[model samples]
Target chain A: MRTRTLYMGMIAALIVVVGLVGCSKKPPPGEIIPPPEVTPSEMPQTERVPGDETAPPGSAAEDAALQIEDVFYEFDKYALTARARDTLTRDADVLLANPGMRLLIEGHCDERGTREYNLALADRRARASRDFLVAYGIDASRLETISYGEERPFVLGSTESAWSKNRRAHFVVRQ
Target chain B: MKPIVHRFSIREPEQARAHGLRAGPFTVALLFWAGVLTVALLFCADAAAPEIDLHGTVVKRTLYRVPIVVEDFAIEASPGERNDPLFFSGGERPEDLLVQDLRFSDAFQVVRRRQGSFDPAGEPPRDIDGALVEQPIQARVVGRMEWDDERLRLKAELIDQGTGNRILDREVAINREGELARPDRWAIHRLSDEITRYLTGTPGCAATRIAFLRESRSGKELFLVDWDGYEEQAVTGLGTILVSPAWHPSGERIAFTSYHRGAPVLVALDLESRRLATLSTAPTPAAAVYSPNGKRVAFSTTAEGDAELYVARADGSHARRLTFHPDIDTAPCWSPSGERLVFTSDRCGRPQLFLIDADGSNLQQLTFSGEWNDSPDWSPAGSRIVHVCQIGGRFELALIDVQGFGWRRLTVGGGCENPRWAPDGRHVVFALTQAGVRNLWILDADSGNLRQLTASPDHSYNPGWSRPARERIRASG
Candidate 1:
C-alpha cells in the first residue's frame, strides 16, 4: 500500500514538469517572462482569474494574452447579432484545436439601469454565447459562465464609445 | 409557464393625467397619509398627548413649516472637571448635530444663534422678540451639559414661542467607554428624535441606521452608517462584490448577495453573532428582501433558465416559484401586508413596475408614463410606493399610490436611483450622481427639501433603511 502511494506522488510531479515544458516551448509573442505560479491561497489578489488549478503553473499569463475574440452586444440585448455569431464561430475553432482546454466566460454590462437587472441581463449574454459555442460542436462541459453585472467595466466613462466597449462577453482559459 | 395577464387597462400619458385630476388633491393627500396616525402612535407611545394641534396641518399636506431656533449648549462641568479636554476641544458639538437632526425632519426651518455665553447654573428669561424678519420664530430648543459619575448627561428643553409653554423636557446620558473626547452622537440623536416628536406629530429618523454598499480598493462591500452619515463601519470583509442589502424586520440580520465563491448567492448575516448562513445557492441570485413579518423572504434568481421570482421560508427551505415570464422579471419588493409583491419586468418592451399576489394571481401594471421604471419599494405606511422613473433619458425618483391614483416626480434633472423610504414614510434616502460624482442624499418628498448624507470620493449606493428600534421614551409625561 505504501509503495502505491509513493508511486502516485511521483506520477503527479512528472505530470507537472511535462506541463511546464510544453507551456514554455511556444510562449505567446510579446510574453518574455512567465507568470509566477499561483496557489489557491493567493486567489484573492488575482480576482479576475478565478480558477487556475488544472492548468499549467505559468498559464495565467498565457490566458491573459489568449488570441480569442470577445463577443459584443447592443444595449439591453442578448440576442446574437450577425457579427457576434461570426466572432463566436472563430472562438469555437480555437476551442476545437485545444481539446484539453476549459474556458470561463464572463458577461459584463454598461453602467446603466438597476444593479440587479443588469446582473440578470449579463447572465443571459454569457449563456447566449455558451449556447452558440455548444451548437458549433464544442463540448458543453468545457465552458463555465459568470456575470459581473455592471460592477466591472473595461472602460471608465459614460459616453457611447465607452459604453459600447463595456457591453461584451469576455473569455478566459481556465485549463 | 403562466400566461401574462393584464388586469387594468393600459392608459396613455394624457389619460392618466386626466384620471389624476378627476381624483382631486384632497383625496390624494387623504390616501397618502391614511396610515400615518397608526404608524406615528407606534413610534411615539407616551402617556401625554401632543402639546399642540398640528395633526391637521400634517394630515392635510399644508405647506406650513414651523420656524424654530436652537441656542448654544451651556457647559456646567463640575469644579474639579472644568478643564477636561472633552468639553474644551473644537470637535463635533452636540448642539450642531441636534440642529442638523431637526432640520432634516423637514417639519421645521431652524436658525442657530450663539449669544455670549450664559451663566452655567441659571436659566435665561424668555421673550417673544422676533429673530428672522421673513418668518417669526415659533419655537426654540435649549440644552445644558454636565458630568456625573464618569458619564456625560445633557438636559434638553423645547419651548413653544407662541404660548411660552414647555412642551418637552428630556435628559440623555452616554458612557465614557467609547470616544470620551467628543460628545456621544447616540445621546444627541435621541434628544433630537424626542423633540421632533413633541413639535411635530411624527417621529424623526435620526436614531436609525442605514446599511449600504461602499466601493473599496478590492471590490464593493457592505457597510453600516448612521442615518446622518457618520460612524461608517464595514460589516463584511470578503473582498468581493456584494449588493442589495435588506434588513430584517427585527434589525438583527441583513440579507444580501455575495460573490465570494465566484457566483452570486443569497446569505444572511446576524449582526449580534456575526454568523453567515446561506439562504439560496441558485444560479444568479441578485436581489433578496425580507417580508414585513420576517417569516419569509422574496428574491429573484435565474435557476430555471430566465430571471424569475421565488418565495421561501426564512431558513431557505420549502422554496416556491412566483413568476414564470420569459423576459426579465426580477427585483421583487413586498407590500406591508406580505400577501403581495411588486416587481420590475421588461415584458412590456421597456422595464416597468408590475404587481402580483404572493400566490401568483391578479397581475397588474403600476406605472404608465415613464419609458423605464424600476426598483419599487413599498412604503411602510402602506399607502405609497417609491421607485426610479426615466424621464427624457435621465433617472429620477418618483412616487405613485398603491391604487394607482397619483403619479408624481419628486426630483428634477434626473440622476437619482435606489430610493428607500424611512420608517416615518416622509423621507427617502437615495443615490444621486451629478457631474461624475455619486453620493447618498435624503429627500423630503412632502416639502421637496434635500440633505446630503455621504460625500466620499468612492461611490455609495443601495441604501437599506432599518426600522427604528423601540427604546424607552425619555420625554416628560
Candidate 2:
C-alpha cells in the first residue's frame, strides 16, 4: 500500500512539472512576473494588470484581457460543475500569474425562479465561484461579484435550452 | 370604460345661449354631472389586466397586465349643448384637472404622456410611455381636456393599451372659482374621479391604504397594520431578529427574513392563513421578494461570504447568486414588469442603489449620494421607485422617477427604514424609530400627509402589508 501511494504521489508531481515546463516553453504574450517569494493568495492585487473600471461592450475578453469559459450548472442547483471548475481555473491562473487582474463574477439564474430568490441565488453562485477562485489562490481583495437574480437571462424563450444557457456564471472585467 | 354620462360646459355665457338653454339649465347639467360622478365612484373596480391564467391551478399562478392609462390634453364633454358646472376645465384645459385626475386615480393606475411644459398640473413632463416603462400590460386610459369661459371643459377617453378600444370618453365641467381654491378645480375633481370610476369599475384607492414596519424593543418584531394605524397584527411572531418585510405583488403573502432560528432564513407567509414556510437558511438575514409575475423570489444572503444577492423559486429551489461582491450587497426588488431589479450595495463605497437587467447583463448605477440608500421598492405602475436614504442625522424615504431623475424626499424623519409603496403607488409605509420609540408611519404620495401607526403597545417593527386582495377569498393555511 505504501508503494502504491508513493507511485500516485510521483505521478502527481510529474504532472505538475510537465505543466510548469509547458508554461515556460510558451510563456503568455506578456511576461507576468510573479513577485519573489509571493504566495498565490496575495497574487491578484500584487500582479495588478491595468484593469478597466468599466469594460466596453466588446465580446467576452474586452477590458481585463481575461478569457472565461461558459460556466454551466446542474438544474435546480447553483454549484459550479466540473466544466465551471475548469473555467474558473483559467480565472485563477490569470489572477495568480497577473497579480493586478481582478474579476467580477456575476451570478445569474434561468427565468424559472423567483426574482428576489434568484437574485440571492445568483449572488450565491457568484460567491461560490469567487470562493473557488480564492480557495485555489486568487486574492480576495481584487475580486467582486453581483447578483442579477433572474432579472437577466441569456435567452428569451422559456424552453429548457434557454434556461440551460441562462443558469450560468458570467465573468465581467472590472478595472 | 367610458363615463356613464358626459356634461358640456357653458363658457362666455353666449355659448350657453348658443344652445338656447337658459342660465337655470346649468344646475340641471351640474346635477347630471354629479350623478355621473356618483355612479363612476360606485362601480369602478380596480383595473387589472385580464388574466390569462397561463400557469394557474398547478401553482394557481395568475398574472395581470400592468394597468396603463393613456390620457392626453382634452376637454371631455358629454355631448349636447347644455353646460354644467361639474364639467372640468383648468390650466391648459384637459392638461389640468382631467389629466391630473387620471394620473391620481386608484383603479386605472393611469400612465400619462409628456406634452412638454404645456401640461397644466406641473406633472414632471416626462413621458410615462416609451423606454422609460416596461412590462406587458393591458389597463390604460386615454382622454383630452380644454378650457373656456370662466369654466373649463375636459374631453377624455380611457383605452386599453393592448386593444385600442375606447374605455370611456366623458365631458365634465370645471367651475373656476369653486374648483381653483380647492384641488384641480374641486367641481371637476369630483367629476373626473367619476370618469375614472367608469374606466376602472372601482372607486379610487387615493383615500385608502399604507403598510409599514413599526420598530420596537430595538428592532425585534414585525407587525402589519392598516394605513391609519388600526388592527395591528404581527407578520412575524419570531420574537427575534427580523427586518425588511415586503408585500408580494398580489399582496396575498409577505416575503421577509427572520433570525429566530439562529441563522437568517427566507420565509413567506400567507397573510390570511399564517401558513409559513422556510425557503433557505443563510449565515445572516437579508431581504426577499416575489417577482412582478409572482413566479420567482429575489433576495440577499451571506451564506458563502459577504452579503450578496440571490434568486430562487417560491418553493425555495434552484438557488442562484446574482452578485459576487465581497462587500455588502443586499436588498433585491423587481421592477413592476419583472424584467429588471434595483438593489443596494456598498461596493461603490457607501450604500447606493443599482439596477441590473433580469438577464444579469446590463448593470447601471442609479443613486449618486454617497450616503446610505437601500431597500428599493418599485411602484406598481413601474413609474417610480421608493427607497430609504440616510443622511448624517436624518433618515428619510426618497422617490426617484422611472427615468432615474427627480429624486425627492417623501419623509424627513430620523429613523425611517424600508419604504413600501401602496398598491396605487401614491402612498408609502415605512419604519420610524425616534426618541427611543419605534412605530410605523404612512405618507401620502402627493401631499406628503403624515399618518402615524402606533398599532400595538409592543415595540413593533418591519411592516409587510399584504396588497389588498381583490377577491378576499378564504385562502389556505
Candidate 3:
C-alpha cells in the first residue's frame, strides 16, 4: 500500500514537471526577441519619413485656427504682387500668434521654363514671401525655404489656370 | 593553240659555187619566208601572254551604309526542356534588339529573312542555306540560344554571305530571365557592338548608357538607362529634386545637383559603392559638369546673391567664381580640350550662350539670333555646340559651329530640349515633350533620322551620355 501511494506521488510530480516545461516554451506577453546584427554598409544611409517634414503641427483645433493661404505670382515672375503681400500679412499674423511654431515656405514654379532656371526663380519667389513675413514682424530664424522647381504641381495641366495655380508659395507649419 | 615553223637556208656564196647553182631568186624567196616565220612566231607569243601596265590610277571613295541581314535568333532546347518564356510571349527577343541597334547605328541597312520567322517550336537550322541568301541579305547573322538549368547560353555568328566566311563569333551567358532583367539585353548589346565593329572600323554605341532625370512621386530623381532604353534604374533615392547628371570621364561616377538638404547642392554619387558625396554646399548650386581630364568641375551657384558660374576642383575645393554679372548665369559645359567653357547667361537681358576661357578671361557671346538659348553641350570633337533655342514659343534643338556659323535647326515639331551627344559624335539624344508627356528620342546627326527611345509614363529630361565603359577603363589604365 505504501509503494502504491509513492508511485501515485511520483506520477503527480512528473505531470507537474511536464506542465512547467510546456508553459516555459512560449514567451511572456509583450516579450520580443532581438533580430540578427546587420553590417553598417547594409543599412540605409537615410531613414526617409515621407511628408513628415511638410506635415501640419498641433491638434486639429489648433491647425484650424491657423489660416495661412498660399501666395500666387505672375507667369515667369518671382516678385510679390499686392494680393501676395496681403496673403503674407495674414501668414505673418499666424506666426506671431504662436511663438513656438515655425514655418517652411515652399516655392513652386510653373512648367514653362528650364528646370534649372525654374529652380532659381522658385528660390527667389520663396525669398520674396519670407522677406515679406520678416518685414511684418516675424523672426527671420523661424522661417525656412525650399524650392520644388516645377517638380510638384498643385494642378496637373498645361492651361493658364493650372499654371497660375501651380506658380505659388505654399506655406507649411513646423515645430 | 597555234604552232609556227622556222626555216633556214645555206645562202653562202662558196656553197652556191660548189653546187653550181644560181642563188638570186631562191635565196631571196628563202630569206623572205624565214623573216615571215620569225615575225609570225613573235606575234603568236605576244598574243598568248598577259600584259602589265606600269602606271597606277587613284580612286576617291565616300562613306556609305553597309548592307547586312540579321536573322531571327533560334532557341535550342532538349526534348524535355521547357521553352524560354521570352521566346513565345511575342515580346522583345534578343535578335529584335540586335536588329534595332543595327538600324539605329546608321552604319548598316539591315535586311530581313522571309522564311522561318522565329519559330520557337522547331529546331534551328545548322546553317544558312542558299534560299535565304538569295534575298538581299549581304551579310547574315545566325544565333543559337540554349538553356541549362537556370543559365542561358547564346552563340552568335556574323557571316559574310559573299564569301560564306564567319566574320564574328561570340558566346554569352545569362543567369536569369525576366522582363525587368538586364543580362539578356546586355549580352545582345555586346554582340551587336561586336557586329558593328566587324562591319565598320569603329565600334558602335550599343554598350553605352545614358543618365537622365526621371520624374518620380516625390521629386525628380537621377536614373540611368541603357542606350536602347532597356534597363531603367533610379540611382538616387534622396526623395528630393535632382537634375543635370554629368558622367565622369571614368564612367564610374556622376555629379548632379540635389535638393536633399532643403537647398540646392552639387552631389557626386559613386555608382558601384552607392555612396553619396557632397561636392558643393552652396545655397543653390546646379548644372555641374566634369572637365575632360576629370580633375575639375564647373558649376553654377547662386550663393553670391545672383546666379553665377564657378569652378572648383573635382572634390569641390578651391572654389572660384567665374562670372560676376548680376544677371543669371548657369548651365556650364566644358570644351573637349578643357580649356574653354560654354555657359548660358542673361547678362545681355535675355538668356544666351557665352564662351569663356578656363581662367574666365575671354568673355565672348556665342549666340545672338535666338531670344532665349540654354543648355549648350560642346561636341566631343570640340568643333560645334548644340543648344536648346526658343522659337515661336516652342523650344527646338539647334546646332551651331564653333565659329558662330551654320546655325541649323535639328528638331521641327513639338518641344525638344537638352540635346546630348553620343561619344561617336554622330547622334544626339534629347527630350521631346508633347501634350504634357515627355519621352527621350535619338537623332542621327548626319541623316536627321529620329527614333524614339524611352516611353516612360513620367517625364524624362536632361540626358547625359557616357563613353563606352570598356574604352574608358582602358584609357584610365
DockQ of each two-chain model: 0.11, 0.01, 0.05
The model with the greatest lDDT is: 1
lDDT of each: 0.76, 0.57, 0.74
Docking class of 3: incorrect
| Model 3 Cα lDDT, one tens digit per residue, B233-305 | 6676665677788998888889988766655678888877777778998877888899989999999776876
lDDT score at residue A11, model 2, on the 0-100 scale:
58
* lDDT value, candidate 2, whole model: 0.57
* Better model by TM-score: candidate 1 vs candidate 3: 1
Candidate 3, superposed: residue stretches over 4 Å from native: A1-69, A80-103, A129-143, A173-175, B1-64, B70-96, B113-184, B194-203, B473-477
Q: Write the per-residue lDDT of candidate 2 for residues B1-477, one digit (tens) a residue.
A: 222333434254567678886655444446444554443333332112111121211111122223454545533445432354333322234344444444444233345654322333343223343323334345444544554554455555555555667766666554444212332343344445455456545444332234444433334544544443433444444444454566666666776665444334677666555666677775544677788777888876777676777777776688788777666667777887888888887677666888887667577889987366777788875578888777564556778875779897765445666667765566666666543345566655665545555533334444544443322322111
Query: How accurate locally is residue B42 in candidate 2, as Cα lDDT from 0 to 100?
Result: 35
Ranking the candidates on DockQ from highest down gives: 1, 3, 2
Backbone clashes, candidate 2? 119
Which residue pairs in candidate 1 collide? none
- Predicted model with the maximum TM-score: 1
Question: What is residue B247's positional error in candidate 1, in angstroms?
Answer: 1.8
Task: Please report the candidate that would top DockQ against the real structure.
Answer: 1
Better of 1 and 2 by lDDT: 1
Tell me, what's the RMSD of every candidate? Answer: 21.1, 29.2, 32.6
